[model samples]
Target: MPERPRIRLVPLAASLAVFALVLRAVHALPDTATGLSAEMTAGAKASGIKNVVTAVLLDFRGYDTLLEIAVLMLATIAVLSLRTDPDALSRRISGVAGPVLGALTRAYVPIMIVVAGHLVWIGSSGPGGAFQGGAVLGAAGILLALSGFARPRWSSGAPMRWVLAVGLLTFIAVALLPLALGGTLLQYPDESRKSLVLLVEILLTLSIGASLTSLFLASASDTSEGERR
Candidate 1:
């Protein structure tokens, strides 16, 4: 075995060096009060949502959220791209589920859709939003897939692309809409801001849900196809 070279840290010298740098950095701090609370409050009020968290997510930092949705869509695309044909994972269930389970799943799905939409609507006045609602909707999508309810919308490339990128496209369109109307990007008229915010959230909820469900189903189906191969 070869002997490795010993590193020379010289503990006392390193400690002094670190301490000096920390002190210098601390001394460089500026004396200014943060306005985070004020900013968040104003943003929420402007957006007309009682849920400050939702306002922040879908309004204050909407661009980031939009990008996040795009990223998710991209990931789903990457996964789906692995296969050449749409039937890559057309198989929904590994085996036939009993009628009881099928009936139960059917009953459960509508309720899930209502709950998911409710969450999106209530987001303006509560701690919920498209992301939360979308999560629920995505769960419903998984259930549908398991029960052999999904019909691979991906069979048609154009519509499938729209489904995956809807959220991002909607956000961008909304932001640019204001510009077309002589307002800044994402800037809504005072009278319609609340309505507009709600509309965006609803759109986002659907898009996110669809995108997430696509990702899950693609992975599941792709894996099944691979196993079969």
Candidate 2:
């Protein structure tokens, strides 16, 4: 007969202790909830950004957004490092795309590109942003890959690397440029606040899109290469 697995008491006790602490912390909170909607709304208005969420993300907490973008870039690098293929970006899926899939990919990819642009453009005033737009763009790339579309040869080269780095570089430059001007970090001049935010969003969208696409292609290529071996 197979032996039953034993529960490790030490680790289980540690987990229970941590859970109890979390429960105590949760229980200590007041029944009533406080919100900062008014404060965020005022901040948004002062910042001249119609979208409160955008104002909070890009102006009030710009450094956090910057770090998030850097993390995404790092993740893409990690994925690429694990890939065995040197030209992962140019690799197509293993099988030929069916007629329906090929036709749909041809039609939808352009629409997805347009939608991504629209998302980024409307992010300043609506419930969309660089991340959302970049996700759509990445999806378009994945669809193309699944449809057996081979990336252009140049996409596997330095230009693609530059595209992946541009977002983080632009963000870092913007963040430090204010310091050079004797202002605090990420503090855009009053006149160019909106413009700066828009610029950052655009560049971030491109970088995020490229990074996500690279991650997918690299992982898929790695899996395919392993199977063939």
Candidate 3:
């Protein structure tokens, strides 16, 4: 007979201890010296972006944004590799509530597109930025996919890939430009800081929006297939 796996309490205890230590370290920080508050105050005047949080995410800590974009790209690629054919699933769904859902999705798609555009455009100056805006756009894509309007196919693959890559590539290129000019990587000491921040934000918004849309569509397709089976 095959042996059953045994639960080891030591590893679990160790994990809990480590987690507690990390939490304690985090809790010990002074309120005024918090990363967010410090970043906000430092970036508020120079970022040109009216929203402090957005400025921090895209400008002050842009390396974090780059890594986030990379993570999103990896996730998108993973999901796409595992995604089911949307057409097959749509055919199955269409037989039942297709028309009703289709109408609703079509009606809302325009509004979603507009909102996403607005979010991306105004992100530098407001609460929304590339990540949030891209999410909104991705949500719109999901709505379309669910409603059976936009079927996933290999033809749309190129644009999707470009969208996924653009943000990260842009960020890398821009970051390197500063380094080439004798500034540190991702540091905009030469050019106006606001200009550099805006450039990064634009790329991030595009990259984030595309990555999210692709991931959502791929996951939705997978879930729909599993349900059918």
Winner by lDDT: 2
Candidate 2 lDDT tens digits, 1-229 = 9999999999999999999999999999999777778999998887788889988898889999999998998888887787666565444445478999989988999999999999999998899989999999888877876677745343356888899999999999999999999999999988899989999999888888888877777765444555897
lDDT of candidate 3 over 94-202, digit per residue (tens): 5333667867887888998788778777876766777777777778766666565666552147877887788788888877777888878878663477776666666
After the best TM-score superposition of candidate 1, give how far the Cα of residue 107 lies from its true spot, in angstroms. 1.9
Q: Which stretches of candidate 2 lie over 4 Å from their true place?
A: 1-12, 31-33, 87-96, 152-155, 222-229
lDDT tens per residue, model 1, 1-229: 9999776779878998999999999888876858588889887876677888887777777777777877877787786776555554455454455798789888999999999999998888887788999999888877776676665555335875676566777778877888988988767677877787787788777777877777766655456555786
lDDT of 3 at 218: 55
Query: Candidate 1 has what TM-score?
Result: 0.75
- Pull out the clashing pairs in model 2: none
Give residue 212's lDDT in candidate 3 (0 to 100): 69
Query: Global lDDT for candidate 1?
Result: 0.76
lDDT of each: 0.76, 0.84, 0.71
State each candidate's clash count.
0, 0, 2
TM-score of each: 0.75, 0.86, 0.75
